[model samples]
Target: MNALLALILAAALALPAHAMPDLVILVRHAERAAEPASDPGLTPAGEQRALALAEALAGTRVDAILTTQFRRTRDTAAPLARAQGLQPQVIEARRGGAAEHVQAVADAVRARTGTVLVVGHSNTVPAILTALGGPQMTEICETSFHHILLLRPGAGWMQLGYGAPSPAPAAGCL
Candidate 1:
């Protein structure tokens, strides 16, 4: 983690004045349900988790919410968006093209000022963090839905947990 913080600090220091965002909070979509195979929404527990997410971020004045078209991602972002009174900007998550999608989200985030909340999938969250100038992150465990990656451009970052703790990951998992 110290390595990551060092990298984050180095990246922040290297950024030009105009490029730094006030803050960027990135997380994997809250726990998903078992219905609709195409795009499942949140479960009852997930709903609670979403509410917990809103509460956890209540102190931060969020300027924007970014979500994908999938129901899970949108659902994960809904509570916070409602609390902040801002419509989530849809940055489409293209299948088989995660790199492009990651870059797009990172670019959109950098273009914006103030706080930005990004609700992404397990597959994308880590990459997005790295794109946002943090270290390369490990994949979030499939059952681990409670971690929050907070980035303060030109300052530092923290990994926090929100809501009920998720079940433990398998050995060697992140």
Candidate 2:
């Protein structure tokens, strides 16, 4: 009985004092210009939105930032990364199959403490969120650039607008 009691106490002590909720902030890369190159950089408005994103998240304690290899995603996350004194880690964007990449990112996030920000394209944002155990969301529209999706694993998810509120939805468009 004493040996079993000791084992129980040891196991209890080994567990974390408190489990911290994982906070994942996912955003779609800011507006991009229609260019001939396969990967185009951000436009002037996109630049402003990027800065606005930095300001919006300045108060939060972001432990890490992740972005795809593309310029647009990297550029969108640059300001915040610089402000937080963190270099954005480059993750591969979904090409053929995103399941592996998404699972890898989700695992990395689960192993960390504090908040994490992932800047991805409109098409990949929803997939990332889903992989992180968040709700399924529609693809972000080309013209909409201000949606910020906050995911707390085991808790819930919420969508908030940052920078400039997305232009009022077009008529007849939900």
Candidate 3:
């Protein structure tokens, strides 16, 4: 018994002092207006939602913020970036493809410690999650604005709703 206990203690002590934190938070851009030019900014409700997101994540130790170049994505991440005192890094969302963008973002996140927040669009959120080795999920609906995806590589992923409940899906919708 003494020998076994000594061996376990020695192995534990040989590990690193601290393991890397693999946390990634993903959210789709807040709601946008119907009447405006292409790439219009967030709507009033969307602005409020963005602020709500900041409040929700205020206590988290965010090391980085990533977003696409679109106004909606940048605006959505602005509040949280300001709150965390980190500038949002603009990565090409659709440069090569969803998989390529997601791979790059995942690589960047894995290389660092602490948490990361990525503001993406409905079409790209699932791709990001999938790229990070998360389980497949349904695409974010057009009317769904409150989905918050929490991903921890090697652990798992969870879908959380923040701010207000997402609007009901259209009739006969999937």
Best by TM-score: 1
Model 3 CA deviation exceeding 4 Å by range: 1-21, 170-174
Residue 50 lDDT in candidate 2: 97
Q: Model 3 shows how many backbone clashes? A: 0
Candidate 2: segments with Cα more than 4 A from true spot: 1-21, 168-174
Candidate 3's residue-wise lDDT over 73-130, tens digit each?
9999999888888998888766558777877776666656788888988878887788
RMSD of each: 9.4, 3.4, 6.0
Better of 1 and 3 by TM-score: 1
Give the lDDT ranking, best first: 1, 3, 2
Q: What's the C-alpha lDDT at position 32 in model 3?
A: 82
Kindly indicate the candidate among 1 and 2 with the higher lDDT. Answer: 1
lDDT of 2: 0.83
Better candidate number, 2 or 3, judged by TM-score:
2
> Highest lDDT: which candidate?
1
